[model samples]
Target: MFKKFVLATSLAAMALSGAHAAEITFDEAIAGATVFEFDGDGDMVVDVRFGTDDPEGFNTVGPGANQTYISEPGLEGTTLLDTDLFVEFLGGAVGTLSFGFATIDPDTSVNFTVYDDNDNVLGSTTALATFDTGGDFPEALASVSFAGLASYATFDFFGVGSRYIIDNFNGTFGSTEDRTPDAVPVPGALALFAPVAAGLFARRRKAKK
Candidate 1:
């Protein structure tokens, strides 16, 4: 199961505003798998938590000339099935992201998915990408966007030996999407179902006994 533990304040934070938008270029790409936190335009909360399935998959390359970044995944004849790239865009902004890709094998594909605070999937896309050693993409368009205001999103890679590199991650965030109600306390939730649960527990114990 996809599981994540979050704080009540973080959930509450999303209710604030969605007018702000922002993006990261990793122009100052860190050398390893680490979390970088920054505030978006007008103070929206944003974070990029870079990670890898194979320790080698987490790669951060040049904050190249003209403020560019190369987010390269390490895999030669291997596969990565899920979000090796995770982002948390709080403060309710609807946003889009673009990247510069260097290389990907012909048979390899990558998937991107965005999620709301309640873990509802907001958007998804799969692509069969290609690139040569010389590198590709002078394309300057927002290729990915959220369905609504999202609290977090993920970029995953898949396919055998799908080693690819991407850079120049530019994102734009605007108004927020329709959001779900925040989670209620367990005690309050239990108030409605407590009696039913007790009955079931007792019946199960009785049967076992």
Candidate 2:
């Protein structure tokens, strides 16, 4: 009875830990991939549309983090300005979200806005000095984070003469059972569970003897 109880508890804890966060590095993504449903859900995770008429949506991956970052296509001479990247959380609202940002232009300020499920603005933030040639394009990239229950977010690069990119997008889901396809079990919880499981097995062996 004790062994069964312990086993059940340990499995429950691991299950709970597995559902807290979801992340996307975009390494597995193709250069022009538009939608990213990290959890394999039909819901739209990200929409990379540039404008209404441009069908070549979803900018190609940038030259950073092993070419894993999503970059702005060369539209400098075109009519496109103040380009924005949108990420939608169609499953449910997330408690927090963060991403890495880089730009070719120095001291560029990028604006981020979070919206609730109703499309109401929840909050906003501006990240500056995204790229200073500190190391490489993605190295030393600016880290931007927003705290709130958000259903979607937009990153705007207004008047940025050069190109910019974002990678390592992460979100903490509001529901503990919400998770992504690549989401892993929490390391701390796994460590704690290992000993408990071992002890339970040992106790069961002794009881059998």
Tell me how many clashing residue pairs each candidate has: 4, 0
Candidate 2 displacement at residue 47 in angstroms:
12
Q: Give stretches of model 2 more than 4 Å off.
A: 1-20, 33-36, 40-54, 65-80, 130-133, 138-148, 174-209
RMSD of 2: 9.9
Location of the lowest summed lDDT over 10 successive residues in candidate 1:
133-142
Those runs of model 1 whose alpha carbons end farther than 4 Å from true positions after fitting are 1-21, 38-57, 62-81, 131-142, 173-209
lDDT of 1 by residue, 1-209 (tens): 12333554554565443322344544444445435554433345343444445554445553223322244321121245455666665444344555554333455555667777798987776655543322342211225656555666666656653555555444444223333333223577879899999999999999998
Clash pairs detected, candidate 1: 71-166, 77-161, 78-161, 149-177
**Local distance difference test values of all predictions, in order:** 0.49, 0.51
Error of 1 at 163 (Å): 2.8
**Alpha-carbon deviation at 33 in model 1, angstroms:** 2.0
CA displacement after TM-score superposition, residue 29 of candidate 2 (Å) = 3.8
